[model samples]
Target: MTSILLDTPNVPALKVENLVVDFKTKNGVVNAVRGVSFSVDRGEVLAVVGESGSGKTITSLTTMALLPSTARTAGVVEVDGHDVLNASEADMDSKRGNVVSMVFQEPMTALNPSMKVGKQVAEAILNHRGLSKAEAMARAVELLDRVGIPDPAVKARNFPHQLSGGQRQRVVIAIALACDPTLIIADEPTTALDVTVQAEILELLRNLVKETNTALLLITHNMGVVADLSDRVVVMNAGKVIETGTTVQVLTEPAEPYTQALLAAVPTLPEAQWDAIFAEERTGEPRHAEPAGNSPLVDPVLDMREVCVDYTSGGRKLRAVNQAGLVINRGEIVGLVGESGSGKSTLGRAPLGLVPVTGGEITLFGGNVLKASTREIRKLRSRIGIIFQDPGGSLDPRMTVGDSIAEPLVMHGVNGKRPGRAERDARVRELLEAVRLPAANANRYPHELSGGQRQRIGLARALALAPELLIADEPTSALDVSVQDEVLTLLLDLQKEHGFGCLFISHDLAVVHSVSQRVTVMQHGNVIESGLSSKVLQRPEAPYTRHLLASVPSPNPIVQRQRREARTALLLSSGTRGS
Candidate 1:
């Protein structure tokens, strides 16, 4: 019997044959997944890449039988050689954490906020392994440590809210690994993370696949991530599989047009191309944009000197920005690049006086922000337009998009006077046309619009006044690559037309490279590096800047592997953990 058992071939970790999923909506039956077929073997990584609503997520969720009640599923889902689709709820409940588990996109949402993180991991272990509370808790701590959570025994006692975003994600990974599941499905696990943190999570997932021989199903829109870890690639579009091949074949020599388009949409840093860009951007205009010649002496649109911003957290004074200096020339876009808590956003907000800086000078339109009175500051703010990261949150849900776009005009008035309704309406329509949104969409609510559409509304609202300076804070971070490209192109076009100097705040280097004439690197509340995009980006001076650049995964598998080899050593030696 032992010889027979040893001789038996290993069953695939997960297999889905001709899967179909449809959601019963008020409009109609929406097909989420149509005849999707794939399998993940032990110690192998399968990546599902596609844009939003491409059924990549739906197919992964079906394996664990976690779809909503309004959805209908059909197909064979086998986990550990056992049928999952036809299994009883009781059987699925028993098998879920034991045979398969999932890591969610948002770690905070995945974890129980009220419970201690360690207990959360222990609970998963206790449910499947039938271990005592103490044993499960002990194992949970061990698992956390294995996943690189420092001082796991102590951290396990802390609530989820106490940990950083990356730490919270690590905790989530620990829960998934607690039961020694044969397969782990990570759905956009690193989507909301910084490049450095994303690199760490990818490393953790890759190590687990190798050390524990676990099958990994990674579903993401990030092609860079696909090249970094996936062994085989599956490209999905409109609920169907458009392409499939090894990672190298799919990324480098994509056979399908859709796959090719998807790969092309990804932003890349071409080092050689950046070398030719203008190095002294303060004196010259952007290559694509002409000088507006607004000021007599051509004063900077926005300038910061020794700017300091502080926030009180947990009874301790925290410096969010420190002595940050930057200058945005007229018709120029200066990119502020940094990880979370690196003070990019804080510094961006300083010009608007939204976050009061504790010290330093902010010159807006050549006026000092530090010495300006509240009335003066308010007046100066009229020349500044702001775009937030979350388009939905930024827009008022109670009003139509038209009303939202005209809100700044309502508050500040048009042409230094209280504008009539007709004027506001015409301006609203003009702005709608400018953003490429139909005038009819003015009647739509924020919730009714798609993510990309809503962001366009944000643009219309920000540019309603056509301010001299614009603050675009991570405007394209939440969008798909294709949509991101569209939004960016439109933003640049508008910037050129309006001749507004822009502070483009984002963590993405490739995006900054494409858009900004100059770039600044931030870390731990300090301005680590700053220069022209040509010099700072291609030939970074600071070690941290190079690390940040290296942390970004390449879409090419071979190049990413080479980058990984060098970056792994740097990260290990420096012990850098992203905020």
Candidate 2:
């Protein structure tokens, strides 16, 4: 039941012809999708690839006939032979979950938080089918199991919040498949997951297409996921399809310059390239920069020995972080890499005392973090800064960006005297300029800025104190590929400018490789491997690290497809043996 060569479907699972969508905004008429035409056949995966504001999402919405009143759309959209372009509201609603379905990017948003997961899946079945409550519930449990949920019956009763991110996504898939849809639109399905969870979800989608002959219209910006999953690709840019071809044709030999640039933005595992990074001359000398430089013998800005974090959950002692040791010398960046629940974040928080450490010795700026009093820790924190993954969340929406950046200076200062309005204002202006934002942007609120801008504002605020150490946790993971590259480049430049030691925590191996001088791999609360990024990325020693690397989807279409096949074969063999 694998996908066949490209061919016109007798009754195309999903089709869009000359689609045009526009919205009347406060500013002017904004064109979202313009003359976008494509078709997805049964059992085939057609990926609509583009970055933010590229009309990839608008085209999908047009097919579902889900635009708001402000939207003006002209198109021929067909779903399983239904004329979706002109279908009535009632007709569209009736056909939505039955004939066509959608798997949203964030499962938490898609699902009802108050309801049990089983009932959510059952609701879809009850929507289209004339099944009794008991029957629908039974069908829901079956679907959960079919989608690879362990203890499906038990899990069905749990609320969405009780499930892990990966599990919640699986429930979403089960809901989408409940009615046996002819077409499924998956919008950035794996963007929120780790590489390992992403691999599982992709495999599930591929198997679903094979088992049920369902067409998948995957809308995403991830080129690696596109190369690994798609049979054909439609490259969209500025509300138009720039190029449309087979995956190999588009990826290996793209005819459009925009497509080439999109591919170029993708980060690669830094193998021998670390040499070039180390060779570059950096001017910013850290206050603690010893004659030994980043040498192992140099006094580290932050050091942890046998670090462990414990939590009380359900009346049981859960050790979130095992005995982990790490050191970050001045002017050097140390990467903490792992999947979700791997304790990398926990380990990163230890030096800052953000989490209660049951055991371990943490030293920051040569001061004992464990033995430090609240006042002492506060004094030590004057030299430390942290940037969270969601910068927008970290910022107060009510506060202006300028105020946010200035707040740190008011809280921590040299000689135990807080900066006055004059000093704070000057530092705020300088910090904003350092992050490449307009000085006037300081007056703007967090909501007024875009995602990338907010992230830059976050960096500006983190560096406002002129700290000697910084902890960046998944800082650029939520951004577009090109924007991610921009942020990383800016961060490295600034790190060099301040000569600050950084502990960069991320699930993205490619990102970790590009930034960190040294890399540590964590798994299940333990440090599994540690070495130079050059050595670890190129030739990983730990089996888990190798699996993590293998899970990363390559941008090469031919190579990724080959790996997918080998992986599928291994999955099948392992399943058979377990059975």
Number of residue pairs clashing in candidate 1, backbone atoms closer than 3 angstroms, sequence gap of 3 or more or interchain: 0
List where candidate 2 sits over 4 angstroms from the true fold: 1-9, 270-295, 414-416, 562-579
Question: Over the stretch 348-428, how does candidate 2's per-residue lDDT look in tens digits?
Answer: 888778898999888888889999999998888888888999988999999999999988777887467888888888888
TM-score of 2: 0.91
Our model 1 lands, by Cα RMSD against the true structure, at 5.2
Candidate 1: residue 545 Cα off by (Å): 0.5
Over the stretch 34-121, how does candidate 1's per-residue lDDT look in tens digits?
9999888889999999999999988988899988999998889998887888889998898887788999999999999999999999
lDDT of 2 at 76: 89
What are the clashing pairs of model 1? none
Q: After superposition, how far is residue 319 of candidate 1 from its true place, in Å?
A: 1.6
Q: How many residue pairs clash in each candidate?
A: 0, 0
